[model samples]
Structure formats: C-alpha cells, structure tokens
Target: MEDVNPRIAGHYDELAELWDDIVASPSRERLLWETFEGLLPDLEGKRVLDAGCGSGFYAARYVERGAEVTGIDLSADMLERAREQVPDAEFVQADLTQPLDFLDDDGIDVICCQHAFSHLEDLSVPLSEFARVLVDGGVLVVSTHNPVHDYVVVREGEYPTETMPGDMEATVETESATPVYDETERYDIVWNSGPDSNRATYYRRSIEGLFSPVLDAGFEIRDVVEPTPDEAFTRENPEIAAGFKQDAAKSVCLKAVR
Candidate 1:
C-alpha cells in the first residue's frame, strides 16, 4: 500500500499548475473528456461522480452536460485548482485507496476516473467497493496509463536519466527514505528531468490486470478504448500517429457495469 495521501497530495500540489501541460494538451484533454462522456449511458440530469478528478478537466465537461457531478481526489491542492477551474461543481478531497467515504451504496449513476485507476496497488478492495457504491447496472469508467509509451520516451530535463526498458511491463518499487511517509512507491518517469528519479508510488496496470480483478470485483467489462488522434490525425502523420498507436502504451478506458 502506498501512503495514499498527503505525499501524493503534496506532489500534485508541487506540479498543480503544470500538471496538464506535462500530461497532455487541451485538445487531447477534450478528446479524452468526450471519450469518457460517450461511455456513460446518458448525460443529462444524471448523478455523476468524478473519482480522482484532477483539476476538474473532465468534471467541468460533465457539469456542462447537466450532470450532478462531485469531484473527489486525494489532493486538496488538486481540488482547490479544480474549484477555481470549475466553480459550479462540488469538490471533495479524499483518498481512493480504501473505500470512498462520502458516497453511499447504490447512489451514483456513473463514475469517471480519468488517468486515475491504474495507480492503485490493491485493486481488489477498491474495485469491489466501487461496485458497492454504484447503483445496479450503473457504469464505472476507468482510464489507465497505457504502459508501453507512458513508460518509454525519455525527454531531457524531465528526469534523472534516460533508459528505456526493453520489456513493456513496469516494476513497482518504494522509497527507502526513512519512515517512508505514506509507503508511497515510485515509477520511473520515462521522460523526466530528475535524474534517477521516479514518479512516487503509483502502479501502472496491464491488460490482464484491467479485466481479471474487474470480473473478480463483480463487474462486467463492456469496452476497452485506446484514445488516439482518430483517423484524421492518423492520416496527417501516419508514421508518427501510427508510432503512437503502435505502443498501445498511452491510455486505456474501461467501462464496467455492476
């Protein structure tokens, strides 16, 4: 188990302003928002939950669609930034590690976790709880870090060193820093400026990891989507876009129902 709080919150606070820039562009975020929105059964007047809603990117979009949206996350700084970014929506600072505390059983219509689900160490517990929280047949939307490309690319000034592993899977490790403030672990950021540095204690999920525990959690996997530039972007930069596509390593969206 990672610290699951305070430390992750701290790191996000440190990177709050630039998190989106480093993650993806506005257009890409829009595409992702639309992708997640399409996963829902319907949007208007639905009670939606934005789990790990960093900076409220997808949160705002859901609110725009007339969904009663509540954005929850481990980072207060994140919720703060989200509040400013989308003041109309409600924000809750909470951890996704255990069970979501504020939500009730069978109360939510849809839940969206963008680029957030893949970071957990213990999926069985939380996923089960997630299913518990959702109304019968309600959808649980999870977006994961496509491990291949996400763990590849080594841009300078981004991290400690540039080393691309031949294998596609990633290993989870922890910090020896005394007392280990949150038991937080680290993933080597592929293109980071910090030498020998790694992103703190977050897990990168695999395909099997996606579905196995999902079934175990009593949910059915309805769809798995890999977000790309669509045919249009792929046509303009066939090689480049295809290269990005080749990895299947960027992100994956899984729509599951209880």
Candidate 2:
C-alpha cells in the first residue's frame, strides 16, 4: 500500500505539466459534476474535503459555492498546481491509502473523490477513514469508470510503446473483469496534450468490488447515477455522445451518506 501511492504519485507528478491540456475539454468530468451538483447539500459555510483532489479543478467549484474547502493529493506537483488553481482552498500533499491524520473525527460535512478513486488499490481503510471523518448523514460522492465499459485494448503494435493515441474506443461487457490496467489490474493511460503525451496508471475494479467497501464502511447508498454529457458538450463531441446514447458511457457516479 505504501509503495502503491508513491508509484501512482510519481506518474501524475510526471504528467503535471500537461495535465490541463490533456483534459482540456473533459466532457467525462462534466457529466460527473452535473450528477453531483443536484445531490450536494448547500455548501455555504460548510466544510468540504476534496479527497484525491488533483489540480483543484473541482475544488475551485466548491470554493465558488462558498464552501471552506481542503484539497489533498498524493503528488506534490499536482498539489502545487491545485494550490495555484484554487488559491483560496487549502492544499495538502497526502496519500489516500493511509490514515488522513490531519483531519479529526466527524470533522467534514462532505467528501468528494472525482476520477481519482479508481487509483486506490485498496478501499477499505480509506472508506473507514472517510466514515470516521464525516459527520453523520454527511455525503460522500465519487465518480469512476463503470465496470460495464471496461473493455479497452491497446492499439495493435502499441505495446512496448510510450503512448497510445486519442482515437480509441471503450467497449462494454458483463462476463468478466477486463484487465484494462494489465495483469495486476492497473490501467496504463496515455494522456495526450497537443504534441506532447504523458502516461499514468490507474486501477480498475469491478462494480461490486468498487461499491462493497462503501457499504461496509456504513455509508447508505443514496444515488447511483450514470450521467450523459450535456447537449452542448455532446454536440461538440459527437463520437463520445454516441457512446453515451448507446449506453456505453464508461463513467458512473455514486452518492452515499455516512
């Protein structure tokens, strides 16, 4: 567990320079924001924790909503960028797989983990820690790739290559867990930023494997949302739009209450 965080952190640290460009038109994240927006309680004067808050993209939104936000990330480089992106919020360099010692019991009202949740090799301790820190009835919102759409393959002859292109399709299957992240279940992501590209790895867990820990941590599942891109975004990117319409949206959101 200790080594996993550093390995993942190092990868993101390397991509820090090109992170924004690669995710410039992040439609997938837009869908997650839409799903979480309605379910989130009033943020005004509330304490919000953006767990695994990379680059402060979502943390800035919380700050705009009047929440006193704290954003934490494993990568120092990512934390540096997050601080710059959301100067008003507090940024901390921390590992998710370890105890969040900086926070006290029942200290937070809401915890949000965006695309970063899937990076955790184990969820038990973190979920328990979330339960410990969140006030009763507090919300925990997370977005991850849906296991149904885990059918992903590297392009032919792409192996032993540094990066993969952007013109790839993600398929869906229910039969077995797809090793998008390789044998150990870590996904090799080639993030493209203009002419430059960067690589990062992420874990892929089955639907049941992903949510069972939350339930075990005493969070009542409140909402399970499969969001589609908004009309404007969809029109701008028709290929991605078609996948959502075909029920192949690779991402999903879960809202739970402690």
Candidate 3:
C-alpha cells in the first residue's frame, strides 16, 4: 500500500494535463455525472467531501450547486490543478487507503468517490472512513470500473477504446496482455491520454467483492446504477455505444445512505 500510492500519484502527475482534457469531455462524463448527481440529496448548504477528487472536476459542480466542497487527492500535481481550477473549494493531498485524520466523525453530509476505488486493494478501509465521517442518513455516492465489463475485456483481449478526439472517436484495439478478471486481485492497466500512454495499477474484483465492504461498513445500499452513454455519446461514437449496450457497462455507480 505504501508503494502503490506513490506510483499512482506519479502516473497522475505525468498525465495531469491530458487528464484535464479527458475529464472535460461532455460525451465521456455526461452519463456518469447524471447518474452520480441523480442520487444525491439537496446540495444547498451541505458539506460535501469529494474523496479521491482528481483535478476538482466534480468538486466544481458541487460548488456550483451550493455545497461547501473539500476535495482530496493523492497526487500533488492534481491537487495543484484542482486548487487553481476551483478556487472556492478546499484541496488537500490525502490518501484514501489510510485513515482520514483531518476529518471528524459524523461531520460530512455527503461523500462522493468517483473512479478511485480501482486503485485501492481493499475497499473496507475507505468505506469505513466514509461511514465514520458521514452523519447518520448521509449520502455516499461512488463510481468504479464495472467488473462485468472488465471480465469481457480480459476474455476478448480487445475493446472499443474511447479517445480524446473532438468527436470522441473509438476504435477496436488489441491489448498486449490480458489479466485475470475473475479473482479479486491487483493488475496493471495502460491508460491512454491522447498520444501518450502510461501504465497504472488497478484492482479487479467481483461484484460481491465490490459491495460487501459497503454493507459491512454500515451503509444501506440505496441504488446501484449502470450508466449508459447519453445521446451525444451515441451520436459521436455509435459503434462504442452499441458495443457497450451489447456487452456490459464500462462503469457502475452506487448510492448508499449511512
């Protein structure tokens, strides 16, 4: 765990510029934001925690919706960009896998962790921290890479990759290596940022393995959403949209209440 955070942080630091472009794509994140935001309660005057908040993309939205947002990320470079981009929100360099000592018990109204769970080996640690920090009946919104989609990606060895082209062009590409997807284990994935690519480690877990920790941490599951591409995504990247509907969703979002 000690070495993993640094490597993950380094990967983000290197790709921070490219990531800014990728996260800004409306076609890529529209459905994800819809699903994530649809589950939240009123954000007006609420204290929101954007856990593993890379570059403050969602934190900006939370602030716009009248929430007091605090964003945390492991990458210093990402935090720097986040601070610059969202001046109203607080940015902190913190690790989700460790205890979040900066926060007090039952202090947060909502916690949103998006696309960050894949980097952690165990979900229990972070989920426990979330439960501890969230007041009773508080909301927890999380999104992660879909294990079902990962299973197909590993079995097929090829997938329709979404690139940062203005039109969001997707092409079927073959993977150099395919890792086992059935077991709960850590594996490396090559993330492409436009012309540049880098390898980062991620955990692949079964659906049961994914949600058991949330339940154990005393969160009552409210909704599990598999977000489909929006109309713009379908119009720009029809082939990729078709493949996603035919096989599995690329990501799954969950809303839980403490």
Candidate No. with top lDDT: 3
**Best by the TM-score measure:** 3
Alpha carbon deviation, residue 15, candidate 1 (Å): 2.0
Q: Report lDDT (CA) for all predictions.
A: 0.65, 0.73, 0.81
Which sections of candidate 1 miss by over 4 Å? 1-4, 20-27, 147-186, 190-198, 235-242
Error of 2 at 87 (Å): 2.0
lDDT of 3 by residue, 1-258 (tens): 347677788878876766678776553567677888888889999999999899887899999999999999999988988998899999999899899999999999999999999889889999999999999999999999898876666556444455354543333233335555556766565555433335566777889988999999999999999989877888987876787678788889999999
Question: What number of backbone clashes does candidate 3 have, counting pairs of residues 3 or more apart or in separate chains?
Answer: 0
Q: Between candidates 2 and 3, which one is better according to lDDT?
A: 3
Model 2 over residues 1-258: C-alpha lDDT tens digits? 335565577767876765665444445345656776766888998899999888887898899999999998988998999888888999988878889999999999999888777777778988999999999989998887775554343222122211123443222222234344332255555544322224455666667788888999999999888777788977777876775676556668889999
TM-score for model 3? Answer: 0.88
Better of 1 and 3 by TM-score: 3
Clashes of 1: 16
Q: Which has the higher TM-score value, candidate number 2 or candidate number 3?
A: 3
TM-score of model 1 vs. true structure: 0.76
Superior by TM-score: candidate 1 or candidate 2: 2
